[model samples]
Target: MSGHGFHVHGPHDHELEHAQAGEHGGEHGEHSGMINQIALFTAIIATIGAIFGYMGGATQANAGLYKNNAAIRKTEASNQWNFFQAKSTKQSLAELARDLAPEDKKSGYQAKIDRYEKEKNDIKVVADKMELDAMHWEKQSDEQMHQHHRWAQSTTVLQICIALAAISLLTKKKWLEYAMFAAGGVGIIVGVLAALHI
Candidate 1:
């Protein structure tokens, strides 16, 4: 017995497991009004799942929108940086021209260089702002993604609760039914927390 995490099973064992599950699904009919109550509770859980599923979809869409906005801002920032580079090139050329020109023309070249410098600074400020905006949008996308994940978790729990309730109805075991209710309550709490984005 290597006794690792994995185990080997025979084909007969697999069939037995399925046969047992099928038997379980067909069993419970002795309890009074128990199955009906479980069916009602299952309906309620399904409704909650539907609502949270919609919320998850919305949050996912919002996250995508924010991500797209971030990409657009980043593209705009790249364009601004390209403009800044062009201005820098022009300023370098103007400085070279001033160096080669006569003393009388030096002032004109100096003025061009000064204007280019100011333009570069302006472009830099705009590009910096665009970068900041992109980062902000990315942060917003991350937040929405977190909310979406929470909603997904809640929805999954609700699904589990519904499945448990169905199983309880089939088995007609009072203890199992109570367990199903407990699971449903936990699912409700999780759903509410997801709605709160916590």
Candidate 2:
């Protein structure tokens, strides 16, 4: 009575069958109705749980991607800073050469120093922009990770609700069913928070 990971009769199905057999007409009908209600609730919760699981996975992937992007931007910024340092070193050498050079050669060294200064400034601007971009990407990654956690929380709560539903169905406990519904409501509220990116 099983297909695709689902069983037509669950673990306590034998007990249920025995109880129904011994029950009179109205009692049997009531038991049947309760089973149907739980079945519907379980199905809905399972579906919601699946959706939440997928969202969690997607958000996790996005977080990873954003983190990688941040790393790349940081690397680019480091490279630009290295370029700037190289230019600074060159400019320092040119300044030293200008001080030691003859009067005619000093102008050439001074021109080289000026060119190096301009290039370093440009590199500094690019490096600073890249650093800012890296920070932005890191922030985005953090937000995505937070959302992923929210989705995971929602999914876990829904799983607990589903487990409660199964237990209620097996034990035929009205209180258990009520608890299952309460858990389901909590799960849905968490899911709403996730959707709103709270």
List TM-scores for all candidates, in order. 0.81, 0.86
Clash pairs, model 1 backbone: none
Inter-residue clash pairs, candidate 2: none
C-alpha displacement of 106 in model 2, angstroms? 1.3
Highest TM-score against the true fold, candidate:
2
**lDDT against true structure, model 1:** 0.88
Cα lDDT tens digits for candidate 2, 1-198: 988998787659977776677465566678788898989999999999999999999999999999999999999999999999999999999999999999999999999999999999999999999999999999999999999999999999999999998899889999999999999999989989999999
TM-score of 2: 0.86
Candidate 1: where is the Cα deviation over 4 Å? 1-30
TM-score of 1: 0.81
Model 1 lDDT per residue over 7-66, tens place: 777899877776666556633323435766888889988998899899999999999999
